[model samples]
Target chain A: MSWLIDPFADFVFMQRALLGCIAISLGATPVGVFLLLRRMSLTGDAMAHAILPGAAVGYLVAGLNLGAMTIGGVVAGLIVAVLTGAVARFTALREDASLAAFYLISLALGVLLVSLKGSNVDLMHVLFGTVLALDDAALTLLCAITTFTLVALAMVFRPLVLECADPRFLASVSRWSGPVHFLFLGLVVLNLVAGFQALGTLMAVGIMILPAAAARFWANSIGGMLAVAATVVAVSSVAGLLASFHAGLPSGPAIILAAGTLYLLSLAFGPSGSLAARYWPRAHLEA
Target chain B: MALRIRDLTLGYDRHPAVHHLDLDLAPGSLTAVVGPNGAGKSTLLKGLTGELAPLEGCIDRGVARLAYLPQLSEVDRSFPIAVGAFVAMGLWHRVGAFGRVGGQDAARVAEALAAVGLTGFDKRPISALSGGQVQRVMFARLLLQDADLILLDEPFTALDIKTAADLLAVVQRWHGQGRTVLAVLHDIEAVRRHFPETLLLAREKVAHGATDTVLTAENLFRARQMSEAFDDTANVCVRPATRGAA
Candidate 1:
């Protein structure tokens, strides 16, 4: 208990970091559940990479400014999303192909920009993240983004579900299909950009997708999945932060590893498609 | 007429699936679009529902309210939605995405569910439902839609006869209410039994009139003939470019 309380008590940075990661978990995991259910996990990964070039450009222009990097990441993500949509619609390439192409290009450009201007330490910080040293602006941004995302999700909840459940029916009934789709995509980009500031682009995706995939094993409804995913993410965040502090591990990778652990645990034990059900089929059948 | 399509050329990738078509679906009538596989039956319904855009000409949707139940295969059945919640989606027009589904709305859903023989299935997850149960659920949703024009694509395909009959009763109820129902079906016997009118299409309008007249041996033979011609290499219908821009 002292070990748990002391780290947070001794350091304001730890408190801020916890708040930031928790905020992200609360907002991003729900969005991640929607992505998983929509089969857009790879899209989330694409957007995460797509944010890199923009953040790198921001880092080059403003030198570690939170506002600049966030704006850059968001713009970059939106551009990739739009380009993917256009290419998929107007060309022979499927959406996944177009998205993969754009993400690869975006990632390459991001690495090039970082290598060209920034030092190795700066690159390390950008790639791996510094959750322990999140500034006032970063914490505030994370909280603001969480609030915005949760509110937007609530507003678009019904149409988003309809759009996912039966797109053609939604299209025939109302003209909100395009708006609902683009709005959901916008939420994905915004959440990924918000997450990258604390978790790094690579590890932020881990916090989202792994928790979401794990949650699906336990629940089938959106509300239940969202709750389960948020819980998994919050626990993973705590475990990662503790590991980073106590064992001298890097925070982002540690957090992702924690999430991966939860995913594995879920795959083995969670009710829906768990190993328990697979091996003990008769009990499940009786139930 | 509930829907009027004039010289409509519906297709994908610039190749027409239903070409040079003129159709007027009468108000308050039951019409079946029966065609062999790939005879543009689905394309024609999609055109009416505004899912597919016509490459040439246009469709005048005379009815303001329209409802559609797409093919079962097209719906992501594994989506995390419950029967009651899904059935409530029919009120989207009135509720506008954000509006609450109040007590009256709940009653409507319950009534709709009862009409389609899906009572007490409110909390059941759609994925847990069998194909027949899912079809019943879709029909209940269609009932709740209260649309002036209802389009159903393979509404009874793969459904057991009892389930089909139960769902068909709902369609009949809608037709009895003087609402126009356009259905795409493969069952000629069901069409002749229930649907008073039929449009037999084979890449073109083979016949369109009374069900018995349209489903005649001669008309079906013509439709089959047209479809077989499609198998040959010389399947393209050519014109002298009369409609090109000046």
Candidate 2:
């Protein structure tokens, strides 16, 4: 217990890091739930990598200011989402093909922009995050994004879930399917951008999606799945933060590693259709 | 309580699947649209429910709320949702875009499950259910919508006989309550016995009126020929008169 509490007392930066982790995870996990359910986890991945160009451009124009960079990231993310959707809907191109094409283009553009600006190190910090250097402003921005995302998610939870489940039915009942889809996708984009500091583009979606997928291993209902996911994300973020602080490792990658561990444990030991289920004496009966 | 359609034309892209068709859906009646494959039976219902845009006509009494159920095959039911949560989607349009579901939503969902004879199965995951059970789940969803205009497309194509009868019984109850139901069916006997009104289509309105008038030999043969022309495997709809008939 003393060792656990030591990090909190010895370093102000550690406390800030922990708080930042909480904020990023909170904003991301619910969005992750919808993403996994809608089979848009891949889209989340593409968008996360897709934000590189926008953030690079923002850094070139305005340095590492939080507000300016977030706007730039969101604009770029939305553009990728819209373009991918249009290619799929209007043309013969498949969704995966469009996503891949857009992802590579945006990534190359980001690389080109970063080269032009001569900030390769800064670009690394932006991509992988520099959570050890987190300050009060970064914490505040994280908190604000988490709160806004949570509030918006709470309001549109039902429709979003339904739309993911059966869009045709939504179309039959209401004329607002298009708006609902865009709103849900927009929230996802916002949360991913907000989470970039703590989890990085490569691992942010993993933190967002894997824990929720793990939660589904235990819960049978939507409400239960959501609650379980929130708990998992909260626990993993704290665990990851503590581990990083003790070992003097990067917090973002450490947090994602912790999340990945939880996913494995859920897969191994969860009751219904898990790895443990296979080894039970009466497992054959379940089948 | 009449759903009137005037010069309703429907299609995908710029091409027309249904053209210049007029229909009056009677209140408190079960109307079945039966025809050959590609005969626009499903397309017609899609136009009415506003899922597919109409190229030409207008729907009278357009303000009425609508509910729709597609064929069991049409939906990807492998999604991880519970029987109760599935039914609760009916209230989605009612909840408003930014609203949270509360006690009222729960009550309506419970009521829908009970109405469809799935009272105790509310918490069961949808993936655990049989095909027939999924169809009932959809009916439960329709009950929660409480929309005056209900449209179903080939809802009984894959269910067992007992399950199909049970679901049709639910539809009969809805009809008795003075709600409008438009169901697409391939089984003519079920249509004749369950629905009083019938619309026969072969890329157009081949026959539209009471079941007895439209279920004649000539119309059935014409519908069959069209079915063969379009897709040979499409079920040929023929209504069997009661065993006590001439």
Candidate 3:
């Protein structure tokens, strides 16, 4: 019990880090669930990579200011999203092709920008994260983002579900689909930008996606998926932070690996999951 | 409310799928838009439902509220939703996006599920449902819509005969209620059986009027011919004879 409770109780930084991770999970996992439901998992990954240049530019301009980097990352990600959508819409290219093209170009630009301005230590920090070192400003930002995200998510949940379920049906019935879609995309960008503070761009997607993917193996409804995803994120974050402190491991990778491990375990052992469904009587389609 | 179309050319990617169509759907009118494959039935349906904008002309949707049921294939059955919740989505128009679904809304959802013969399936995830059951759930949603006009596209394409007949009864019930209904259907005999008015369409309108008058053997032959040679740029449609109001 001491081993479990000592790290959070003794260190204020650890407590803040734990809260930060939980906040990111609460916001990011639901967005992650929607991304998976819409078959846009790769799109999330692409957007993550695309945010690098913008954050790097922010670092060059302001030297790791959380607000600047967040705005830059969001702008970069939005540009990629919009450009991908536009190319797919106007040109003969499909969405996947357009996304791949735009993300690759943006990724290259990000690498170039970061290398040009930041040192190797700064580069490592940007690529990984500094969760255990969250100051007051960073914690406040994370909490505010989480609050907005949860409220916006509650507002959009129904329309967003309908949008994901059958966009054409929603379009026929009401004029709400397009706004709901842009807002959903906006939430994704916001979560990634906020997650960037603690998890870094590359690992933020892991925090967003892995828990949601694991939850799918366990839950039967969207609301259940969201709840289960948040739980998985909480467990993963706490376990990963404790392991990092005790075993002298990297915090970001440890958290993601913890999530990945849970995903594998759920895949095998979840009651209605793939492996269990295979060995048992029920079909996986019930999920 | 009536739906009026004038010289509507609707399509995708600059190619006109439905070219130069003029039509009128009076308030409370029930008409079937029937045609062969690639005959622009879906394009026209999409245009009427306001899903597709006219590429060349205009449509006056006299009603602000309408409902549309796309083909079953258009919906993702893999979504993790229950039959009851899916039907409840139709109540969004009344309850709003963030509004709570109270006992009244829940009762309506139950009545709709019961109407479609899906009683006591409130919590069953939709992915486990059969194709016909999924179609029924779509009908249940449509029932909850309570719109002034309804547009259905290929509603019975893959459904079994029983499911088709049962769902068609809902269409008849809507007609009985004096709500306008426009459906894009493939079964010609079924169209003649139930729909009082029919519009036989090729890339162009072949005939439009009473089901018995429009679905003639010659008009059916012309429709099939137009579908076969649809890409011919030199194609000039020459109606054998103009049916009334065509």
RMSD to the true structure for each prediction, in A, is 2.9, 5.9, 3.2
Report lDDT (Cα) of residue B38, candidate 3. 86
In candidate 3 the C-alpha lDDT for residue A115 amounts to 94
B1-246 per-residue lDDT for model 1 (tens digits): 788877788887677788888788889999999888888888888888777888887788898898888774456888988899988888877798889899999999999899888889999889989989988888888887889999889999888989999889888988899999999999889999999999899988888889998899999988887643333344566643323221
Taken over the whole model, the C-alpha lDDT of each candidate is 0.86, 0.78, 0.86
Q: Report how far off residue A253 is in candidate 2 (Å).
A: 1.6
What value of lDDT does candidate 1 attain over all alpha carbons?
A: 0.86
Candidates by TM-score, descending order: 1, 3, 2
Backbone collision tally, model 3: 0
Clash pairs of candidate 3? none
Q: Report the TM-score of chain B alone for all candidates.
A: 0.91, 0.84, 0.91
Worst 10 residues of 2 chain B by lDDT: B237-246
Q: What are the per-model numbers of colliding residue pairs?
A: 0, 0, 0
Worst 10 residues of 3 chain A by lDDT: A278-287
Model 1: pairs clashing at backbone N, Cα or C within 3 Å? none
Model 2 misplaced regions, further than 4 Å: A89-95, A279-287, B13-15, B61-63, B72-76, B92-94, B97-108, B227-246
Q: Write the per-residue lDDT of candidate 2 for residues A68-139, one digit (tens) a residue.
A: 777878888888888887888899998879988998999899888878876667777777886667778778
